[model samples]
Target: MGHDTVETPNLSFGRGRTPGRSTPYAQYARLDELHSLQHPRSKEPAELSFIVTTQVMELLFDLIRHEWTIARQALREDDLPTALAALRRGTHAQDVLVESWDLLGTMTPQEFNSFRSLFGEASGFQSAAFLHLEFLLGNKNAALLTMYDGMPDTQDGLVEALRSPGLYDEALALLARRGLELSPAHSEQRYRPSEEAAQAWRRVYTEPEFAALQPLGEALLDVAERVTRWRQRHLSAVKRTMGGKPGSGGSSGLTWLRKSAEQDVFPELWTIRNEL
Candidate 1:
């Protein structure tokens, strides 16, 4: 049979005579429930854009975290190609996340202010999914997990992630398996750049025998750079809309975000470049 002439099955939906019968896409996606989530506090036209943008960012955060988890698991299994593929997908998702601000970028300060007061104690800092993404990227901090204490299920998930092996941990483990000496404490604690870690990567970059690690290192750096760009863009967005005002959840606003941007994830990956 010619390719274009191949017959495809058209199964009947069997959604009896109801005028508003649900389609398979809607049933699988729960799109009606998803659309119902955007209950803006005010009738201001800009509020819908603001709400939808925030929701989209949240979904992207989850997407990135999911990819990171897959990469971390692949590394644990010594599957470098799978891990690198997943990390590359994560970078693309982060790129979308960075551009998501453009939606809100269209709103003026007055438009944001119209609905800002309605946000109450809510803030991006309260985003469990973003925190999960950070945790998978090895930005562990038990103190920050306290924010979710009010929600036991969320707090438990954060606690589990806090103790679980992170992406950096898996990377270090892979290096160790390849005969490099490393302390388990490196994974047990929040990741910090160390001389040994840098030398390990230097070997990967410099020695032909370990060239395989180079792509993984570069993939991780890609993720790190995208995250930094996101932080910078987020800071700019906040400054443009809110000025120096305190963030909704008692955060120090721009000062806090700028400091966060300074703390680079995958620190040793960047430092090793100087040696190369």
Candidate 2:
């Protein structure tokens, strides 16, 4: 008979490489799984680099979304330090995503064209988690939501994330907690620029006492800015590979991505920056 047993990660926490350096079974178990994830369609050697880079970026994006979710909850609860920690984690994740792009940028146009046909209908457009991340950031679109309905479980996760408040929503809530007036409607799933929210953030910027929240605001902006950079670079890559062509996923390629890049996730977060 098999009994229920929970496996714990055997990690050696120590000061230096001398004590905790050699982790055999535990390290091997995780790394082996990571190694098996890449299955590129093409025999071309460079395909491995492209596939691995995209996968790594996706993993980083998942981590960032998770951290932001936690941070948003913490801010909603008026827990500053916990919110700050999560935001810091998110910023670190953003850095990793940007660096992953740099590695992918190494793939020449010829190399991408080699594997492009093999990808068929598989595009970054089909990344369910990425769509959910976008929806979580209050960039919800009915068309995008419908794309996931065929995949019930994926659609469910996205629906939940969409209904939840974003990092900006929580920040506005925090301002309200700090005696600043913000409309209740600002917390809704659809993003709309609130003149009142902007005024509140402007006050927070002017006051030294609200400096911690200011840093939190700037950290959120850093995340938004980096993500925008990623989208732009992705568009650039698409143009470089297949100039003015339709995407493999049935979109207008660079044109679609250009429109997407123009849409800001947390609109008021950026608008407030101008006022501040």
Question: Compared with the true structure, what per-residue lDDT tens digits does model 1 show for residues 1-276?
Answer: 556686443334432325566668877997657867989889799999988999999999989999999999999999999999999999999999999989876678899899889989899998999988888878888889778778999999888898899888889889889776665453435677888888888888888888877898899899999999999888888989888899999999989988988988889889877767
Candidate 1 Cα errors over 4 Å, as ranges: 1-20, 184-189
Model 2, global lDDT: 0.75
Name the top lDDT candidate: 1
Best by TM-score: 1
Candidate 2 C-alpha error for residue 221, in Å: 1.6
lDDT for 16 (candidate 1): 39
Backbone clashes in model 1, listed as residue pairs: none
Clash-forming residue pairs, model 2: none
Reference-based lDDT, residue 22, model 2: 41
Error of 1 at 83 (Å): 0.9
Q: Give the Cα error of residue 39 in candidate 2, in Å.
A: 2.1
